[model samples]
Target: MAVVVGFIPTPVGFAALEAAQREAERRGGPLIIVNVVRDGMQGDPRHADQGQLERAQDMVRRASVRIAVRQEHTDDDISDVLLQVVEEEKAELLVLGIRRERDMASHLLGVTVQKLLTSSPSDVLVV
Candidate 1:
């Protein structure tokens, strides 16, 4: 079974990675860490591409995580790509990090975690 972890643009992303790593380790399943590059950067494509991806890779490396890491570009909302990956990869579990916010309006409006939890057919684990 594949464990899919969604990497967002916050510390929560790393937290999610850590939690997923632990769960994957326990379950003895392959883990795939994916960071969705959202559209809208007014700089060199190479720089924009490498900036976030490299950091994410470094985090995995530093964590000594034994998992496959993939970086993907998406023009659509983050939730869209996340759900697509879940289906395409046949992920049995989805893990994400959600920052606690007092403003429920923001999350209810359209947060990635919320959308993933509601839309995913498989089990979702939010750290």
Candidate 2:
């Protein structure tokens, strides 16, 4: 199965991509880059815009790794979208970047990452 690396527009996300690239290189497997964008008012009306998909493809191209980039527009929360992508791809691995915070413990106490970790059915590599 392909390795699906979920990308977000964050420093941690980029770092996770780097980690995924390294792992892909070592394993000699194809990588699929996915960016889950929420579309709507509470999220962003332009989340489904073609420009966003182009940008995601550009980012994947710039990564210089053989990858198939996909932009998923959904009304669901970002974390939920990510898990959905994982299930859809039946991915061999999932890579994510952990954002830097003033207090790591406090940040982990929040919802996003913790929720994903708790709900994920596959191996997750947090960078």
Candidate 3:
């Protein structure tokens, strides 16, 4: 089975990528990095640019594990797209990055993370 990770351009997203790579190496499986760009949202910070995608790919390559990067533009819900990839890849684990408010005592999960946590067919890890 593969290890799937949701990647954006943020630090948290890179963290998730690193975690997923380690997991993939541990499991001796391939890594699938899914970067989703919401359709008609060119200005969205959540979407990764070409440079960012290349950087992520390079990072994974240096890890010496098999990698497949899927950068897609979609109008569907982010969680749904990620779940679909996980299903298609037959992923054993799904990794995601979540933002945390420094002022809050507890970190609140994002909409996508919440949805995936409950709906994903595989196990999930949030960084």
Candidate 4:
């Protein structure tokens, strides 16, 4: 139905958006970006400021492709939110921004990344 992307304002996040947009265009579907902030998170640069969000919207506008951006702060885990959006939109693909893992203990390859990879119902693209 659409390409759902987990978005922040980070470099990997931007990369995910770009790749998802291209994939959506190729699939003839719209792009849906889910920008999220974990509840009570403070000063996390990942959460875009109003200016940054507006800029992202402007960029999407210039790209001239059908897109929907949803920003929210949730008490639930980020991975859960992403998976929920995928089902809500009936997304065929899920794009995510990922950073390399540092250790092999319980921490795992970024907890949320691992969670989403294992749990999402749609095809996942880690950018």
Most TM-score-accurate candidate: 3
TM-score of each model, paired residue for residue = 0.75, 0.74, 0.91, 0.87
As a whole number from 0 to 100, the lDDT of residue 89 in candidate 2 is 69
lDDT by residue for model 3 (31-117), tens? 999999999887999888889999999988876568999897799898899999999989999998776545222333456667898
Candidate 4 is scored at a TM of: 0.87
Worst 10 residues of 1 by lDDT: 41-50
Candidate lDDT (C-alpha), each: 0.72, 0.69, 0.87, 0.81
Off by over 4 Å in 4: 100-108
lDDT of 1 at 68: 77
Cα misplacement distance, residue 27 of candidate 4 (Å):
0.8
Query: For model 3, what is the alpha-carbon lDDT of residue 119?
Result: 95
For candidate 2, the 10 contiguous residues with the lowest summed lDDT are 40-49
Colliding residue pairs in candidate 4:
none
Per-residue lDDT over 1-127 for candidate 2, one digit per residue giving the tens place of the 0 to 100 score: 5567777655666677778877766666467877777765445532434565465566556544478777877776777878887788676678877667756776566686787778877778877
lDDT of 4: 0.81
> Model 3: runs farther than 4 Å from truth?
102-109
Position 113, candidate 3: lDDT:
64
Instruction: Report clashes for each candidate as comma-separated counts.
Output: 0, 0, 0, 0
Best by lDDT: 3
